[model samples]
Target: MFTFLMMLLLFVPIGITVDLAEKVGKMLENDVPFGEIAFYYLDFTVYFANLLFPLFLFLSVIWFTSKLANNTEIVAFLSSGVSFSRFLRPYMIGASIVAGFALFLGMYLAPIASQGFNEFKFKYLKKNKSVQQTKDVYQQINDHDYIYVSNFIPKTKSGLNFTYEHFEGNELKYKIFADRISYVEKDSAYKLTTYLKRSFDNGIETVEKETQKTVQFPFELEDLTPVEYAAETKSYGELLDFIAAEKRRGSPNIGRYEVVKLKKWSLPVSIFILTIIAVAVSSIKRRGGMGVNLAFGIAIAMIYVFFDKVFGVMAEQSNFPAIVAVWFPNVIFGILAIYLLQNAKR
Candidate 1:
């Protein structure tokens, strides 16, 4: 835990300083207030710390264990009638404490920081909100009602080629079409341009037309145009509720949300996996000393991060299951951890 805290203290400020330098020009151009800029960095620190959590734990374990090995402390402990498994008890206990803290950060604090970080970027750094908006959206608002838009601009709360349909027992009962639709957040209403509606009752049809109309719908602006970072903004409980709601609505972003949900648990579990690997890799005093152990630890950390990112991308882009994608790295590295531990024991 001391090592972990020291790593955080050392790395977080460096990351924040670099990030602030990169964004300072943009913030200055936007005339952002100093208070807001400070808050943004605070959120950034939380986000960066959570992101590099596993690496921090891995490095911490390697550093201390390598020092012990160099001092022949581990040899002394083992020579004093301590089994390798027994020697690992303290490391396991420390890993459990770190894992609990990581779980809390991932499930609760990280989401809030992610939301704030993305919000600040979108609001200040990005001039074009269209980059964050998804196009050709189709959503089922309810069991009988469906809506579609050819193009949506989330910043403007507007869309083009909007169509809404209602069905009764697989029969289209009503349909509404508009050349353009814009949401009025203050009024909780929508303005439709060149609006037309058709209703059918017992094979009889009734039609209505309007050049422009303001109407209330059963959905909000977010329902019409969801930001790509929607899942990142929600806490664990909120994410569960949001995913369930999206599933009922047949949202296309379910895969992404599931990835986020699974990652929350997987990250914490990885702390233990990485801790074991670090201890096994660095517990032996090598001719090259601590440098060799650190190099090996860094390589393993890179591989772990690469696997995580590749699988996460696959899950988001393909039909890969999010749970499998999130846990695959842990499973692979878990096997490595066991192998290393056995070798270290021998």
Candidate 2:
């Protein structure tokens, strides 16, 4: 526990420092206050630190436990007739406890903190002001109707030269065109502001609608809640619900969000897997004292991290299913852990 706490405190501050320096450097380019950037960095780094806690836990357990073994304590224990597998029971128990807490934090608390941190960043330090290169944007406000924007600016909640279509299955119902569109937040409901509208019947026929005001009615704007903004929301129930809702509306972004949701649960399992591997690798003492074993453990952990990023990118980009992509690295390492464990037991 002392080792775990020490590593946690040390690494978290290092993470915070690195993030703050990066944020401050970026803010300097925009002439924003270094303190403001530092705050944002701190917020994000806290969330990141929590996510990395499992790695720290695994490292501490291996480092300290291996040092104990190297000092002849494990030798004495073995001489006392304790089987090697039996000797691992306590360490396994501790690993299981850490795994449980890791799951809890990943699936529940982390998402809330992620939401808060993202919101703070968006409000204060967002570098981009507009949506980039959208070929088509579609939204269905009600039954049998949808709106499409060729280009959109999320900063202004506005789209340029938009078109709205109404359809009943395969039949063309009605359509509308606007020079520009925007959304305004109000106490009760959101207002969609459009400069002009041209109504169409039978797909091709168009009729102009004269309006005194610039805004349009019956258009639903997006919810501004953090739950709406964050893809990192915890709670399997909530994620499932959100995925169902988005799928019904035919949203593409929902796929990646679901991927992240599933990954949260899978990531905690790496703690257990790494624990097994570390124990296996560190059991046999080498001439370099504990340092060689420690170096191998860290190297293996780094390889796992690299594998993780590779798969994460594949999940994001290629046609590979995100669920499969995210879990592939874990699957590989789990096999490696099992092999190492068996070999070490001999």
Best by lDDT: 1
> On residues 1-346, what C-alpha lDDT tens digit does candidate 1 reach at each position?
8988999999998998898889889999999999888888889988878878889999999999999999999999999999999999999999998888888988889889998898899899987755444578888887888899999877677899999999988999999999999998789999999999999999999999999999898887777777788898788999999999888777888888899999889988899999999999999999999999999999999999999999999998788999999999999999999999999998
lDDT of each: 0.90, 0.69
Residue 33 error for model 2, in Å? 9.0
Across residues 201-221, which tens digit of lDDT does each residue of candidate 2 receive? 555766556432354445544
Model 2 score (lDDT): 0.69
Alpha carbon lDDT at 103, candidate 2: 78
Candidate 2 residue spans exceeding 4 A from truth: 25-42, 129-135, 140-143, 184-219, 223-229, 233-235
Each candidate's number of clashing pairs is 0, 0
Best by TM-score: 1
